[model samples]
Structures are given as C-alpha cells and as structure tokens.
Target: RHPGWPARLGPLLVPVGRVALRPPRLLDGGAWSHVRTRDRAHLERWEPTSTVDWADRNTVLAWPGQWGALRGMARRGQALPFVITVDDELAGQVTIGNIVRGALRSAWIGYWVAGDRVRGGVASVAVALATDHAFNVAGLHRLEATVRPENAPSLRVLQKLGFREEGLFRRYLDVDGAWRDHLCFAITTEDAPEGLVARLIGSGRAQRP
Candidate 1:
C-alpha cells in the first residue's frame, strides 16, 4: 500500500445508456447474491475457489461488511470497486484492484456479469468504462487483466477493449480449485489518451450501450 493515500473515495457514478457503474450499496447484498448464485456454475470454471460459501444465504446477508471494506480500499486510492447496473438492476461488478502508486501507477481489472447478460455487449461496455475511469479519474498509467487460457468470452472482452496481449503466465492463478495458466493483457493511458470508452465506441469494437 502507498503512504499518504486519500482517506475517502466517492460517491462515484458513470452512466452509459441503460447501464451505469457505481459502488456497491449495503442494500444490494441480496441482489448481488441472487445474481452470483444464478451464475455460479457458469463462473466457476473461470474463477478461483471462494473463501466464502457463496451459496449460503447467511453469508450473503453479511455482505454489507464486505461492501464497506471495498469502499474503504477505494477511499485509500487502492481500488475502484464498482457494480454495473442496467436500468437500476444489478447486472455485474467491475473492480480495478491491486493498485500501485509511485513508479508503477497501475492496477488490475476484473469483472463478471449476470448469466443472462453474457455476450450482450455488457462486458465490453463495462470494461471500457472502467478503463476510462482508471486513467481519467484514478490517474493511473496502466491497467491489466488476465484470462484463463480457455476462457474465450473473457478473451473477447479484453480484445474488444483493445487491451494488448502481453504474454502468457504458467500456472498463473488458482481457478476453481486448480492452478491455471493465463493470458495477460493490458492497456496504458498513453495508448488511449482520448478515453478508452470513447475509443471503443468510435472504433466499433463496442457499440455505445
């Protein structure tokens, strides 16, 4: 963690058509759990084993603490934790975590969407928006993301966002209880000075929501 970090983050929101990006709220625990439960099987193959039992209703009911912690990290300029919504319904989450300041000025981006929203251009738009926020609002220089080698949908999302493939990492992370290889991808502020969301829409890599 960097020293002298800000003590608070926001009240942040970014709108994109029917979709908007904002921080998680205490009242959203139930909705978040419902979406994740529905998508658990679908997400398992690509995600790491949960430290918490996601299927347990009681665990979900306790999410306000987790949400608060997420906001705390954001307040320190250590992360940007966001929930994506479509017409006020919780559709997904996009987080820019592992923030490094000083010489690095970078962070990692991660996200997941509701089962029904996969391939509906939600991921692309969400990624673009987060990328813009990282560079413009967070004042970061670079943002990175990694995908399991076999995760085609995730790869497509990064591609649409114009994240350049950096290389491959062997046994990069624990995923679904197994060590998995991953493909690294990244985008730098210098790579899209005009704003990544606008770039994606203009280049037609992703349509305006």
Candidate 2:
C-alpha cells in the first residue's frame, strides 16, 4: 500500500447540491450492469472496446470480482473509483487513476454519465468533486483527461472545469474497436487556488441543487 493512502478505505463522500460521489459497492453490480447494458450504444462510441456481453447474466455475475479489483487498487492508493449519484441514485462514475507520487504527484481522471442523465451538469459536478478530492484530500498535484476529438459533450465538461488543452495524441486509445485520436486536457493544483468545484460553481456552469 502507498504510504500516503487515505486514513480509511473509502466510501468517501463528496457532495454538492444533489450530485454526489462515493466508492463503488459490491452490491451495486446489478444496477451498474443494467446501466451499462442499457446504455451500450450510447456509451460505446467513447469507450474502449469490450468483448464481454454486458447484458449477459455471466457478466453481471462477474461484478463482484471487478469491484474487488478496484477496491484493492484503492486500498493500495493506485486509484480512486467513485460512482456518481444524483438524488442518491446511481448516475455515472468518476475515476481518478494512474496515481504517481513523489516528483510527479499526478493522476488521470475519467468519467461517464448515464444517457438519460446527460446535459444536466452531472458529469461536470461529479468530475469537479473528484478533482477536488484528488488534489485536496488525496494530495495529488495534477490531473489529466483525454477525450476523443468527436466527443463534444465530454470535451465541454473538461473545458467548463477549467482544464487547459495540453495537446493532441494520435491513435491515443482504442475506442469501440479502432484506435482513436484524442485531445489531452490537464489541470494542476495551481490552476484552481479556490478549488475546482468552487471554480465550476463560480463560472455559473454548475448550480446548487
């Protein structure tokens, strides 16, 4: 385990208005699987290709193992995997991964929202909360995110949170099936002296519920 790990293994709650983030739970498998299955077409375009059939019962049965793996990583301080909630209901996920301490003190941020929940600022608020935790609570210096060039909504989420465009990476990640070009966006602790969530709220891009 990393020496800098949070004092407690988390269900760490970061809430603002109706949006909240919490660690993923073992029992959430069914709901999580359902959302992914239902949003297959909606999400696959931006997601890495997966061979598993999300709608299959076997896939749902595998949730515990997946959750366990993430939990282990969290325990080791390698990642922060959080499920986004709205009005206490599952809405999406915001994950802080690839943490590198010491000289770098950086991590990667990634997220997705349920199809029906899109355009409501759920992604923005969830990400802001996660970024705040990564910087303030988890003691990271910088956070980075990548988006496919065509993912306008996701690009907007990063932009609204004040992440600066770093550059573009060709064939950066495999999406759906083919390798796709991606734009890199990053934010450092110095970028938001007041906190990312506060910056987001002040910009009028996110509102209190």
RMSD of each: 4.1, 3.4
lDDT of 2 by residue, 40-118 (tens): 7888788776786546633578789878988899898999888887767777888888888999999899999988778
Tell me the deviation in Å of residue 6 in model 1. 12
Mark the regions of model 1 whose C-alpha exceeds 4 Å error after superposition.
Answer: 1-17, 57-59, 204-209
Clash count per candidate: 0, 0
- After superposing candidate 2, which stretches have Cα over 4 Å from the reference? 1-17, 207-209
Worst lDDT 10-window in candidate 1: 4-13
38 Cα displacement, candidate 1 (Å) = 1.5
